[model samples]
Target chain A: MVYLHDGSFEGILSGIYKMFHAKAKIDEGKLYEASVYQQSFFELTLNVETERENAHRVASSIYESFGHEGFKYVYYAYLAEDDSYGTLLFRSLKQAYKIGHQAFDALGVEDIRLLTQMANKVSRESHLLLGLLRFVKLENGIYYAPFEPTQNVISILAQHFEERLADQVWVIHDTKRGIGAFYDKTQYHLAPLNSFESLQYARDEVAFQSLWKDYVKHIAIEARRNLPLQRQHMPKKYWQFLTEMK
Target chain B: MEIYEKLRILADAAKYDVSCSSSGHQRGNANKQLGSTAAAGICHSWSEDGRCISLLKILYTNQCIYNCAYCVNRSSNDVKRAAFTPEEVVSLTINFYRRNYIEGLFLSSGIIKSPNHTMEQLIEVVKKLRTREGFNGYIHLKGIPGADESLINEAGLYVDRMSYNLELPTTKGLRLLAPDKERKQIIMPMQQVRDQMIAHRDMKKHLKSTPSFIPAGQSTQMIVGATDETDYHIIKIAEAMYRRLALKRVYYSAFVPGSTHPAVVERGRPPLNREHRIYQADWLLRFYGFKADEILTPDQPQLDLLLDPKCQWALNHMAYFPMEVNRVSYGALLRIPGIGVTSARRIVNARRFSALAYDDLKGIGVVLKRAKYFITCNGKYCGDGDVEPVYLRQKLLEPPKPEQLTLYQTHPEVFDESEATIRGLLT
Candidate 1:
């Protein structure tokens, strides 16, 4: 048996909810996102429609059984850029149903270990983007930041900024994924936005950016020039939105 | 001067002080707040020199009254000089912070008229950022030597961390390089700050809303290769400071030749390797539970350039090798060359469920190549039944595969401590 989801966190959980209810005995790797479902040995497949209530019920049950850290790992693992995340997360949750919180523990198990690895990678990338994400002030006084993260971590970064910069209105755009998280002064929501090529900057945006570039150029000690070390900390792929790098 | 030109001049002058940490401060945002500091900090960008630009690390003013020979902002230097007004500094901080260009402000300055006056100017910027601008972000204010105790106390209230750079390790080096700055003057402020932090923490234990005073604690920076102090002297001083003063961190910066003074330049290249080794040794002191004397003795003070301090210590003290992975205590597991704090803890936890064989070690995040030689799996040795120091040293220095050494070079991050040292992430 195979279960296909819509490649969203809720979609994966909702699909898992159906799998748990039916108790269908299935082979390994029988679960995947609908977009990534390749023709494998499995013959029977079902595209599980996303059920918001079912997803919420499954998530709360995991939170109740596996603890908060386990709940976070499930979400972060789903956010990681891996095709096996859906299958592994579903299997781990199934294992969690029996073993309780010990499912996140028991690193010797392959499914739990791989799921933990993905969650750690996604969490680490989100933390890095929190710092590396650069913001530009728009003419309308909204703080607009755009970056292309390897993982689907725009929501994590958005939630961080929604608290850190609560009073200021901001928009965080994922250039590669064509999605943006917009926050008003009161609350925040996610929306699709691809047209960020043309932006009206505040009057002093270019001036402050130039000043930042000048400061970066001068603050670096001339004798201690190590581009390789610089790349190791701030990888090359993240330089596009960096005003100083530009 | 224009703000652009002033920023360049002031930032260039302030680049010599190499304390860029923005971690260990946890301040939550209030209602409709503009900023909040994270305990695990956020590094906005890495500079060309490969250092983190956590804060807007600029001097409040480069106009100095004292002519310190090793300082770029020295009164005797012919370089460009600039000073920022209170409004200019406040505006730059708020704007840069809003754009996510920096974590917060790292405001240091050259001595102006008096130490008290210079300290006041630095405090004013931070106070305006906190009270007037409503910023709860991290603020690392550099303390002015010879400043009054009252001023240091007041500044500690508004800032997250503070430091007074000792520059050189020994008092003799201070006398030679920076004649105006005294060792006692620098040490006094550190002592006072440490006392205040202790009192604040004690008060917080009783009252929840005591209003944190330097919640991030104090850290100091020392120039490594400038003076004639060896790694032993520098590490010893760092250990003492960490022990006696309870300093959060002690940053070491290698001397950048040909930039500051004519007499200061001894070689074309700075002693970067030596500086890195000292940082690793310092890591062993702080985290790895190794003593300063254990790292270096007076007879053989120089750390091995090729091997890390932990590996060197493991080689020199061979009696502690072949530690049983399943049965050895967590502290003993940390003594293994390749094992870190994370791996050691993981091994302890994983061992509870099942005995960790050599095959299972990799699953628990152990770097097997480095740990295999020193650690054992259920009393089975990975290298050989018998340990030979000379052979082990040679084998460790050689690349994993001889042929691949020609085809590719291993990244510096392959080893953990050295990477932390160079990247300034040694917390």
Candidate 2:
């Protein structure tokens, strides 16, 4: 049986809480977008309200079975925003919980190692995006930027950019999940920027674009010309909004 | 502060000095500090040049007294110059660090006023970072060539790493191009720091309370292709730096052809592949148990610009190839062109489990393309068993002739004898 829950981290947690309370040994892979799973199997559209107490218990269970770091490992991996990560994380957490805290120490084992490695990948990707995110100066004296990060770490990235560009009003739109953060001098939040494309990007965006393009061209030396090396360092897919490319 | 303008200028100037590896100092935030530096090093970001920008790699000042002809920020260049106050640098380091943008600082500077004066400013920046700011991050401070030994020692106490760039590779090149600087002016200060570090370790062994100097050790940068000094000369200097001074690294910066010095060859820059080959050669000397003289001689001193130093060495000594993968010694496995430290270790470990098959060689991380040319699996020749040195070399050189390769594949042509013969014809 497959359980379709609202695509929210808390909602997914609540589903896990319900499964545990119901004593259901449902496979982690059972959750699908309705098309892929077996048709005759039981399907539940879970609307379990996100209980703080249940979330805490679930977190506590993982910590008790693993450790404090293990809890954070699962949390950040969940924050990775990849749907596939959910099943992998769930399976790992379930297996670890079943075996207790001793299983956490067996990190060299492949299954547990995979989760730890995934967590590290998400953490590193989040850190790299901190420097790579390009902010364009908008016409209204605001800085606007967009990113399609593979992990749900846009908020963590926004905090650093916000501090660095504190003087300006800006918005960073995470185009993939339609969520973003807007900072107007003193405040910021992860809000739905669904209509961000229509929301006018400032006029000076063109000037900043030219400046960055000029910077990249002049800085990349011809004597040490290595485009394949450059691509290996900064992949081409990242060039769409990087002012250096345009 | 005008330091912002200076920061851009000096940081840009310091960018090409490639000794910026930030490994080997791991300290945790012990005093309730917000962040800590790792011993294995951390790369926060890579710059547009595709080089890792882990530290705040900037010059304390670009104001130099020495006019090194190959340097862009040579005193003669009428460029916008700037200097950072020690306080300003401290704040910038902390602010950038708090935001997790950088691991720490890589503070180098031109000879601002005098070597002692410049060394003082460098020391002051680190003093404030370590003592005043409560910062325990990895700092790599460049020692001024003519700085006072005491000042250099003081600077060493606060920094994680220190370097004095041997701007040109050879003494003759140093005289012809960078006339104002002498070889001793650089090496003397490095020797002082290294001796002090060793003395500190000895003191610590006796007196438990003794402090260390530059825990990550010292590294130096040599500007490649700036003078007539060949790869053999460059690697010789590197080996000397490691053996004599105990330098942790010897960075090779490929000279960009902007200098109008008469001694410089202006027809075309020495290929980046040449610099890459030198670095590979340097690694072989430092870690892979090869000597500078063994890699190249004064007669055949320059590295073959097409094949890596290891592969080039392997080619010259073809009798060592086709060794049994399961039985070859760890040191011998490292000499194989396709085998690295990682694969060598894997081969050593996996051999205990089972006699490795041809398929198992792939799992052990051998470059099948390169290793097949060198090794045999259980006496089964994976590559052409006869190992014609001419035919083998051609296959290796053909891949990147259309487009240049990375620092890793710098001298792809050096891999094959036929390619070398072809190139000799064209030249």
Candidate No. with top TM-score = 1
Off by over 4 Å in 2: A1-148, A151-222, A225-228, A236-246, B1-4, B205-209, B349-355, B363-365, B384-386, B400-427
For each candidate, report what fraction of the true interface contacts it reproduces: 0.76, 0.11
Candidate 2 lDDT tens digits, B1-427: 4544555666667766776677877766544443466666766544456666577777778888878778877888877788878887887676555434467888888887788888888888899888877787789998888877888778878889998889887888889888888898988888888889899999999999887789899998888877777777788888989999998998887778865656677746645777778879888987789999889988897777777778778888998878888898999988888788877876776576458888776644456788888888898888864577777777666366466557447755565667678889999
Q: Which parts of model 1 have CA positions greater than 4 angstroms off?
A: A24-29, A39-42, A97-99, B260-265, B384-386, B398-427
Query: Each candidate: what lDDT?
Result: 0.86, 0.72
Consecutive 10-residue window with the lowest summed lDDT within model 2 chain B: B28-37
Q: Rounded to one decimal, what is candidate 1's iRMSD? A: 1.2
A213-232 in candidate 2: lDDT tens per residue? 34234434546666666667
Error of 2 at B127 (Å): 2.1
Give TM-scores of chain A for all candidates.
0.94, 0.76
**Model 1 C-alpha lDDT per residue in residues B149-187, reported as the tens digit of each score:** 999999999999999898889999999888888999999
Docking class of 2: incorrect
